[model samples]
Target: MTTNAIVTTPAIQRLATARAAVVKAAAAAQAAHDAHSNLLVKLADAQARADESLSDFRSGKIDEATSALRKAIADADAKDLQKMINDSAENLAQLNDASNGAMLAEANAKVAELYEQRVEEGSRLEAIISEIESKLLDAVVERYRVQAEIDPDSLKWMKIYKPSPALDELVRRGRVPGF
Candidate 1:
């Protein structure tokens, strides 16, 4: 083979490898973005569910037995008794003594518990998504570093060959010949 062909072979191989790395990094970034989007959707859905549950509890739409069960469990494990009482049965009773205040309290407590759990889950998912985003960024930076290492001159060429937006528009409009 000619000297030019011999030299070009390794260059071509390096270019292909760099291109593949870029494609892989792009795919990974896209997947991470998709996961982040899904987590946002989940967070919204959890919030909506929490709101609906709270509304149902307040409106006496939840069953009495279920509400009582929830209250008993939550109250037994509660750290802030005054807050729990204020947020639960006592609060409801104060609002309307004739209403099923105890049941409503239990239901409200349960709704709050579920809402907190969902928020925690959303927080964990957000952290994971953040980690994935960081990893994607690192991967891209590493790929660029590797490419620069393999072909230092390419960076100089890129700096010199910056595209002109006006020229690009003219080319697209068939007013300038495109190369």
Candidate 2:
């Protein structure tokens, strides 16, 4: 699956079987990632830890690093980062298309219904995208509410957006997704 090698280095970072380093690196990454929701920030921290761990492992004196790096990758809130990425891409594309009526004029129906449910009454679209972006960010924030959270995703959590029963219906019918 990995077409390229996992490289690191003052030297050429080779993709060899360094089990201890690899395992430790994954754990460290997960721990760092768990602390943040912004994937870029999370992975930046993770990479720093991995780089340090790998460097230490290469030197054969990894005691102090081992304990801290032992956090299980499975414990990560987004253990399936790849899956989340795929889901986000697919969901975003579908929702965007529906909103723009690219698929069909009727596709807008789905988005309008969702808007009615999620957006506050009498709140007109702010430049067409401002409100939607806010909602998505809020939802993602809620997903990582333990740490990387800033906004409430649903009305129950805030006065900003209301819950959409239509959301449940769309999910039930597989009409719209990942709202």
Candidate 3:
């Protein structure tokens, strides 16, 4: 109804929409952070086991056993170590891929949400313009109704500003010229 209200409605709507989008993006980032954290724990455990096995071999623990049995356990432990490394490598790769995917998805979602906001802002601005136009029409009608009581010049009131076609185009595109 009022000029300020008409001008601010679009801004308020845009702010609400942007806030929701930010919350969603933050939640996705947090999930990715937790997944990486879990992978780090697994990696640390694997590293500890590998280090302990290497220390035993370096300290002559293997030399104390009969050569055949020593060779067997050493081979088995080597295989175990290799398997652990392979598993860790695979897990790390998977973790990297997952985190990368999450980041990409979050970026894409945020971009999509921002575009949606642009559309919403454009629509809200259109509504505000419509409201202003309607209010101006009402004022004009009231002035005409009081034609006999008031001088035509004395009834002059503020006029509505025309919609900015360029601004509408810019907002729709979400950027300035050449972008």
Candidate 4:
């Protein structure tokens, strides 16, 4: 009923809000991925070192000393590797423990879930935006159609931008019944 108002303004506002959320989610997701990736790298390095240590210990003390040295070294260096693995396994649920180097899994999972949800929301926003754009174009064309009907000056102007000659020819032929 209000001719002056652009009907798509509210949707555009909603789109801005949605875009902000998407940006935030994407950023958090990237940060989480970076952290998880770093922890994994650390775990990998620790595992390699532990493997080499265990291998050296095993090779050097292969006889009667094998069992005792294996036990001692495994107890000491094994703890380090185990702790690293556990740290890598930590997730958002272990946030408190994570702060102290105990959990990465929970944070990784939560952020990944958030990322998925925000991406879906962003997709919905994109769909609605596309719909609004399409309808707005239709409204513009209808406005031009109506103006071209009554005003010869508008008809002349419309002719210049006609995508094809059909609409222009219809207007040129004068306002007929169906048209």
Candidate 5:
């Protein structure tokens, strides 16, 4: 019986372990993201139900029961947001912990394989996060632009105007009039 030395290396074992760990972590993160999406849907549904209750109450279709249910739904939505935030926080912590372990495994594993997997997964998640951030920024900018077109005071509140210190100095120096 001939034993192949190439198949028994400690480095090979570590590389296999690292690959498994990376796959597991990605699966966990995907699951958490799915859960977050589900919670968001639930929160939206609760909000919609609350709105319906308010409309019914306003229309006199129901009594205090509608207001009570609306309040309960609002509370549930708030709790759902908190739960989503907590879940994200916990998942991030777990990812951080797993990453640290994976780094340790890299020392014992095939460097190229470890590095390649890490970079691929990191870049994939980074792309997802970047897309989400861009969407959020676009929405905020759109909202601000619309508000500016409607009411300039919203922009003023957002401090998108000239610096306060410079304006203050100008006002103090009588270069500008105080309104």
Candidate 6:
């Protein structure tokens, strides 16, 4: 009886090639997913920092405006203004406080607007990531379906063609050549 070395057929080569392509595509998709996830984390952190900065700015502006108004009122009292002037100065102080409040409110609204924009951007990124993941899954499934269509005997030969691990360590490491 004569024994011949097993030869790899064209179909087996194609299957192996397809599998490699699928693995590479999956790896690329994973990297992209990681990058998008990182972007989301960074965006959230930036939004938090921006919100804190806005709060600090509002607090500082209010404190400074209040301090200035108090100083003006004290100065007016020291001058012993006539009742009419005193009343006018009091009204002026009230107007200044109202103006400061209005400005602060505007700034707060602007911050809220900016926050909404960031949220929208984040949502867009998430949608893109989801789409990419779905496409990758489809590609993998299609590749597997194509592989399944190959003759079972040819598939078995392809499996046999894979290099066997010679060392126990290699086997323990789950290393398969051409995989």
TM-score-superior candidate, 4 or 6: 6
> Residues 1-179, candidate 3, lDDT per residue (tens digit)?
65654543444555555556556655655665565565556556555555555666677664434444555565666566666666666666665665566566556656766677799889999999889878977876775667626665554433323335665576586655555
* True-structure Cα RMSD, model 6: 27.5
Distance from true position, residue 91, model 6, in Å? 1.2
lDDT of 6 by residue, 54-169 (tens): 55556784465555555555445434434434455555555555555555555555566566668878999999978976896677666556666874444453343332355334
Tens-digit per-residue lDDT, 86-114, candidate 2: 55556555555444443343334445554
lDDT of 5 at 96: 63
Show where candidate 4 strays beyond 4 Å: 1-8, 58-179
Q: What would the C-alpha RMSD of candidate 5 be, to one decimal place?
A: 31.3
- Full-model lDDT, candidate 6: 0.56
True-vs-predicted CA distance for residue 122, candidate 4, Å: 26
Ranked candidates (TM-score, high to low): 5, 3, 6, 4, 1, 2
For each candidate in turn, give its C-alpha RMSD to the true structure in angstroms.
27.1, 32.2, 10.5, 14.2, 31.3, 27.5
* Best by the lDDT measure: 5
The global C-alpha lDDT for each of the candidates, from Candidate 1 onward, is 0.56, 0.50, 0.61, 0.58, 0.73, 0.56
- Per-residue lDDT of 79-135 in model 4, one digit per residue for the tens? 665675566456432443433331243344445556666887899999997897689
- Candidate 3 colliding pairs: none
lDDT of 5: 0.73
Global lDDT of model 4: 0.58
| Candidate 5 worst ten-residue window by lDDT | 157-166
Index of the highest-TM-score prediction: 5
> Which 10-residue window of candidate 3 scores lowest in summed lDDT?
154-163
Candidate 2 segments exceeding 4 Å error: 1-37, 59-61, 64-79, 102-179
Q: Write the per-residue lDDT of candidate 5 for residues 73-176, one digit (tens) a residue.
A: 78788687878767777886787677667757765577755676788789999999789768966776777788788977667645543436755676477565
